[model samples]
Target: MKRRLLLVSNSTLHGGGYLQHFASNLTRRILFVPYALHDRDAYSKTARDKFKTLGYEVDSVHETPDPVDAVRKAEGIFIGGGNTFRLLKSLYDSKLVTEIRKRVLEDGIPYMGSSAGTNVSTISINTTNDMPIVYPPTFAAIGLVPFNINPHYLDADPNSKHMGETREQRIVQYHEEPDTPCVLGLREGSMLLVEGSKATLLGSTKARLFQRGKHTTEYEPGSDLSFLLTDAQ
Candidate 1:
C-alpha cells in the first residue's frame, strides 16, 4: 500500500481561520489526535468545530477507550500542534506509534499533521523547536518519512540584533551528528503532500532543504520532492 501524508508547518496562517488554507483536501471522516496540548477536551472541541466548517467530522482519540482501535477504523488521521515531547510521550504511553505506522503505511489511510504533529511524523523528534517539558521513551517517531522536519521555519532577519542562532544554523548543527538524515525547513503556511514515493511542496511559501554536506537549497510551492524520499534512504 502507498502512504498518504500531509505534513503542515502550521495550522493557522496569518489572517486565516483554523485549517482554512487546506480545508478542501481533508477526508470527510477524520480521527483527531489532541495529545500535544494540555487540555485534550478543549483541543478536541476546537478541532471538531474547525473540521465541521470544512464539512468533516472528527473523532478525537482522547475520548475513546481504545485509540489503537480508532486508528484501525479511521478513514484518516489528523494530529494537531502543541508540545512535541508531550505528544510523543502520550503516543508512547498509548502505544499508538506502531499502529499508526501500520495504518498509514500498510492500510493506506491518510495521515495529516500540523506543527508538533508534523514533527512526530519524521524519523525522530530531535528537530522540533518545542521544549522538552516531558520525555518519551525515545525520540524515535513514526518514521513515515525518511528525513527530519523543522516546522514553522523562519528566515533570519538581517536587521535583528538578537544573538540567538538562526533556524538554519540550528539545523546545520543537527547535521554535525553522524548519519543524521536530511532536514526540511518547512516555512509557515507551507506543507508537504506525499503520495506513495512522490512528495510535493504545497501552499504559499518555499521550503529550505538542509543536507549533511551539501549547500542548502530552496524549493518552491509546486516543486517535486520525491528525491528526498528515495535519496535519504
Candidate 2:
C-alpha cells in the first residue's frame, strides 16, 4: 500500500478554516492528535465540529484508552498543530509514533498534518519554527517523508530592523554541521499532496527549497516534487 499524505503549512489561511481545504474528501473516520494543544478536549471539539460539517467522524486519540489502537482502526489520521516539543513528547510517551508510522508507511493509511504536525512527519524536527518549551525523547519522528520540513516558512524581512537571523539563515546553519537533509520551506496556504512516492506542490504560493551547498530553488504551484520522496533507507 502506498502512503497518502496531505502535509500542510498551516491549518488556516488568511481568513479560512484550517481544514477547509479538505472539505471535498471528508468521508472517513479520522483519528485526531490533539496532544500538541494545551486543551485537548477543546481542540477535539473544534476539529470535530469542522470535520463533522463535511460528513466525517472525528475523535481524539487522547480520549481513547489505547491511542495506538485508535490509529490502527482509524480510516485516516489528522495531526493538529501546536507546540512541537509537547506534541513529539506525547507521540513517544504514548508510543503512537511507531504505530502511526507503521500504519501510514506500511498499511498505506491516509494522513493529514499541519504546522508542528508536519514538522514531526519528517525525518527530524530541527527545522520547526516553534520554541522548544519541553524536551522530547529525541528529535526523531515518524519519517513518513525523507527530508526535513520547515512549515510556515518565511523569507528574510528586509524592512524590519530587529537584526535577528532570518528563517533561511537559521536553516542554513542547521545544515552547516553535517548530514542535514534538504529542507522544504512550505509557505502558508500551501500544501504537499503525496500519493505513493509522488508528491505535488499545491496552492498558490511557491515552495522554497534549501539544499546544502546548492542554490535555493523555487518550485511553482502544480509542480512535480516526487523526487523529495526518495527514501534515505
Candidate 3:
C-alpha cells in the first residue's frame, strides 16, 4: 500500500500539523524512526511513547538482523531531525542509507523527513549549520532529494559563536561546485508534500531558495514544490 510521509524537526503535535498528519493517517502503517539517539532504549521510549499516544503500532529497531527486509515491509517512514552529521553517520555505518533510497525511490515507499532528516536526503549534509557533534567516515547522504535543506531558517541567532559556517556561507562554499545547486532553506512549520515523483511545499510562508554563484529567492510556501523536487532527485 502507498503511504504519505511527514518529515519535520520539531512540532507541537496540535491541530493539523506534522503530528496530526501522521496520527490521522494511521490506517496504512506508520513508523517513527529517530536517528538522534544512540541508546536503543532511549530511542524506543521517545518514539514509541509519542506514537503510542496517537494509538499506532510503533516499533523502534536499534539493530536489525536484516535492515533491507525491515525497510521493505515498512509502509511509511518518518525520519525526525537532530544532528545532521550524526544521522548521516548512522546511515552510513548501518547501511540504512542505501536501503532507504531503494524503499523511497525504487520501491515507491512514501518517505517523510524534517530538518536534519531532510538534510540527509540530499547528496551531502555539509551545508547544515548545526555543529558536527559526531563524525562519520563519508559525507554522502540518501540523495533522495537533490538540494540540501537548511532547517530553522530565519530564526538563527546572528550573534552566536557556534563556529562552522552559516547556511548562507555554506551555500557560498557549495558554489565552488558549479554543478551543485546551493541549497533549500526551509523555515520551521514548513513541510514538503511529495507524492510519487511530484513534490510541493505546503505552508503559509515561502521558503528561501539559494544556489551557489546564483541568486536567492523567497518562495512562498505551498507555491510549488517542483523546485525542491527537481533539485532533490
After TM-score superposition, the amount by which residue 193's alpha carbon in candidate 2 deviates from its true location, in angstroms, is 0.7
Error of 1 at 111 (Å): 0.5
lDDT of 2 by residue, 111-155 (tens): 888888888899989998888999998999999998989988888
Local distance difference test, each candidate: 0.88, 0.85, 0.65
Q: Rank the candidates by lDDT, best first.
A: 1, 2, 3
**lDDT (0-100) at residue 192 of candidate 2?**
85
**Model 1 lDDT per residue over 113-185, tens place:** 9999899999999999999998799999999999999999999999999999998889999899999999999
Q: Which ten residues in a row have the lowest lDDT in candidate 1?
A: 12-21
TM-scores of the models, in the given order? 0.93, 0.93, 0.81
- 5 Cα displacement, candidate 2 (Å): 0.2
Clashing pairs in 1: none
Best by lDDT: 1
